[model samples]
Target chain A: MSADNLTRTQRDDLRTIAAMIVPASDAYKVPGADDPAIQADMLATLGRDTKLVAAALDHLARLAGGPFAELDANRREAVAQEFRKVGGAAAATLVRVVLQCYYRDDRVLRSLGLELRAPFPKGHVLPDGDWSLLDPVKARGGTLRRAP
Target chain B: MKDPVDVLIIGAGASGAAVAWSLAETKMHILCLEQGGWMNPAEYPSTGRDWEAKFYGEWSSSPNVRGRPEDYPINDDNSPIKVVNYNAVGGSTVMYTAHWPRLHPSDFKVKTLDGVADDWPIDYDALTPFFEENDRIMGTSGLSGDPLSPLTHPPMPQQPMGLSGAIVGKAMNKLGWHWWPSDTTVATMDYEGRARCINLGHCTPACAQGAKSSTDITYWPHAIRAGVELRTHCRVREITTDENGMASGVVYYDKDGVEQFQPAHVVIIACNGVGTPRLLLNSKSNRFPNGLANSSGLVGKNLMFHPYAQIYGYVEEPTDSNRAPPTCLWSKEWYDTDLSRGFVRGYGVQFVRGAGPVFEAVVSEQKGILPWGEDHHRVFRKLNGHRLGFSAICEDLPEEHNQVTLDPVLKDSHGIPAPKIDYTISENSRKMMEHALARGREVLETAGATDICINSPIPWGGWHLLGTARMGTDPNRSVVNEWGRAHDVKNLFIVDGSIFVTSGGVNPTSTIQALALYIADQMKQRLANLFD
Candidate 1:
């Protein structure tokens, strides 16, 4: 919603790029990066490095031969592949920000069957694993350094 | 503020806290000054939605990146290794992984055995009792009778190794290597009022459950309860000496940036390797022109950083990698020297879990292993829980050229000269790393891992800063004597990793604490003629 550093078209193009990276499917009803919450997070992260975002978006627009958001799905995919091929700091930053925002969303956690709670206050409990697998290691005696 | 205390400690870190706890038994007034304040568990990153961001932001373990008001940055331009430290009351323990391992018996006599690096003034047997005492106080959890180490019992039960540990253990068995569940300072059950670990998995930035044994919760509370005074946010600028060249007290900047001097009967420097040398070098006077205790001119020389490497791979099965601590299992089979490998000392290998989901996604994308469009999810899922990693902690010998010096231009917030680190990996360490990487690949392959990616020596791996002011018997070659007492100034002592003569192949926290306790005992016995 607060695309302070980005124009309207740039925001839409970024949303499209994020959606292509992690598109919504029926198998896991997770929201794509086009979701409002996810977009806001992505925009905030992108706002930190506005120059990098601007450069990456300009590259995508040139690859698609127009506004990247106006391109079809196939064209968008091709343009994204072109951007990936010409990998630079801007492209890497864009991918990193988009992935960080998408994967940390609550819907993604639910889709992955994980509780959306803080890691502390009520930490996760792991079942006791098989200790017998270490029997062989324990059977081998001490391997101390030999004294001079 | 009130009066000159019986003893003055410069840092409230691991060694300082331990020394305070031990010396409090003598009923002497003990005071400690810490540059950073107490860390509250409630303010930990895990309690927020943006927990992962903390690792890259304010909660970063490196002082160069964290940049708090009290932090002093290190000029690491000349070194391949970067220095990482946390300056709070618990020192680097606040952000450490809590992997506690003692030095081997031969680690004491490195010169006699390997004909390189000076032997420690004190041996492992002499410090065994203190190590055992520290384990009881710090609440370590492990099984007894590790063949690679001397026999010792932990007070708490061991943590679960989970699936990754099982796979790695089986691989070590196949390779006929010595692997064991690493002894950690995390509490399993409620021991000594700290809560049990719930496997939150973020042990580096901060442990919110109060499970990891940072010195603030482990030793500081006990010391404070026994009537020790700890002044937070007070940074010591220089150690002042009397007319006779004996350490009388220190001139420090208080919490409000006010300059003040506190006199004490005995002064102890527990401010780690770099900080200790910086303070000593900054305290230049007419009596000691080069530095305070630099008659030997070795105060900031012979710095050793344990060169580290991490090897990651993808396992075949879908196993849970986010359910346990960061590291719970390690191998010492390659710890000692093997002449055929063309290296002097060896390295320890640890099997650890990968970071959180977000971190993994970033790493995978950056490494070009995961594509951007359409193929992201597939590669992410394939590498999610089905990943394993091994980190090698290689021993770096003492080299006179790799040292800590005062930067002429760089100044901290207090206008003090910043510590300049000049270090490079030795040929011996490079050969050791090569051998360790090959061995790591063999282990991962034997354990049925594919798509293996082995990284070079990690750049941000200078967690264990040691050997700047090495301990020895002769005054001409060393800064401190066998008892951690300065050879030049009788009333001055250093009880941190700075007194280490050699950098061992494991984490240095356990040995640092034990040496602090041992030095405190020596002070108690020689109380009558301490300044003589």
Candidate 2:
């Protein structure tokens, strides 16, 4: 169940679990975690944490008593819920690895309408928020620390 | 390699680089040794997809976790707070949040005002000129005439106070507290060969745009042009002494692991709180068996690490969390003592934009709030831009028992002894944290926040390392004198946060650099009598 050389069934289970964490939706037009790019990136970055990912996927398979990929969407979601409920090192690692990889994907950023480029060279500009709300604090003059 | 230089400084970070820049003006033969090499801004995380990995991977700000060839592992078994620092030419400034708040006038007179920590030998008024000079050199960006500080104008304009800051500011106003734009080392416009900040939001791990004022780009260039020689990957093992017990030079391991003794007429130690003490303590000699310049036995004593308390909440309004630097607004309402709060000293609070999505997910999971399955997206969507956070930077008193000692077993790649930390949160700090958390929650509630999360004593919050080799007027109670000269050795000087008498409730880099410049001035004034 190595991340680099995952068995087909293990890979399928991982994809299914990933999709459950970040499901494909028409509303956002975002690819699910099952997208090949997202899955590959997750597996690549899991490096030392591959075993933890495998254990988490294995936990899902054991709960479902079969390949999690073959289960219905609701059943797969249920199994993920159970895996998360078990709450161990493997479960937490899986959640972190998946979320980290998923959010970093260009497709996810595009789906959220965020600029899909590196943050340097040209950074994002935030519109000024209503700062008049701070009038009261400014009007109170200043609060100084006790004199020495 | 060369003839004995006039001045040899160790560590090319914030303080060391400032010393080099200032002393280079005198046209002295200045040579600085850095344990790590210069970092290329092009290789920063902002240029790649794996930026978040920098926080936990090799580029991590924590030396214990970064584990570079030059970094020595710290033994923090006895302390809950873990040290977070980098060993590079620019040092921790490379990964700092760039929150540049000056110490209040009361901070220098803590002993007289609160009867707590010892007063600094030099007061705020004495350091004001140096602070202004550092501001000009570093290109600090903020509004002028901060009521708490003496400085009138900064070199650059203030960075925008984002939505998170507005919400927090509103909360402070409702609470009738003092809030202001945080003075930071980020440039708003092009200044001093550095580009303006593009608001990449992530100031830590690295700033590819060269907007952040890391000394590698800020002071190193000027120092080098002024004839200061900087040798990277040169880890100083110990400060060697002459037959007369005067400071001589240092025995350091070169990049190729070759041991070499570089002699100098004067030795300046700016290797930070942990590194400075570790080098001195390991430099055991016949004259000073305890440590070099440790006649007062305060070289590694009275270590102060400011304990932190963080409060996070979710707002209903969306925000551009990734559009600005993490910290923007801060309040000093509770920065001074109020005996009614059951604490002698107090803490300052800063408003922070929510972290990136990955960070939010990890924090949510840690807090047991991240829902599983179908509920995940619902909760995540609710958190995304609506999240806001604030941190209470509490002052830490110098406790002799809480100190940095040489680790018996662990050593760096250069075979230099590692530093072992023994620290516990004081009752005063605890009480301050408790009060701060309550105030933070109240502010968030006033700002229309729901589902607030509170985490006290953030484990990885030992950012400002200070008070180890503290400065004082009495040689029996401190390591360095008013001008940062070692009390026990005439030619030895310390110019880092380690010489701080009290840990102020704010970032210490500005003060550290100012003190370094002040010490360099002292050295220049008595160049002929330096070793007398």
User: B498 in model 1: Cα distance from truth in Å?
Assistant: 1.3
TM-score of chain B of 1: 0.98
**Which 10 successive residues of model 2 chain A have the least lDDT summed?**
A139-148
Chain B TM-score of every predicted model: 0.98, 0.98
Q: What range of 10 consecutive residues in model 2 chain B has the weakest lDDT sum?
A: B144-153
- Decoy 2 TM-score against native: 0.93
- Give the per-residue lDDT of model 1 (tens digit) for A1-148: 2348677878888888888777765556777777889989877765445677777888888888889999987877788888887958788777777877887899887766667877877777665678787777677776577465
Computed on C-alphas against the true complex, the DockQ of each candidate is: 0.53, 0.45
lDDT of 2 by residue, B54-78 (tens): 6765777778877888687899878
lDDT of each: 0.85, 0.84
Cα deviation of A61 in candidate 1 (Å)? 9.4
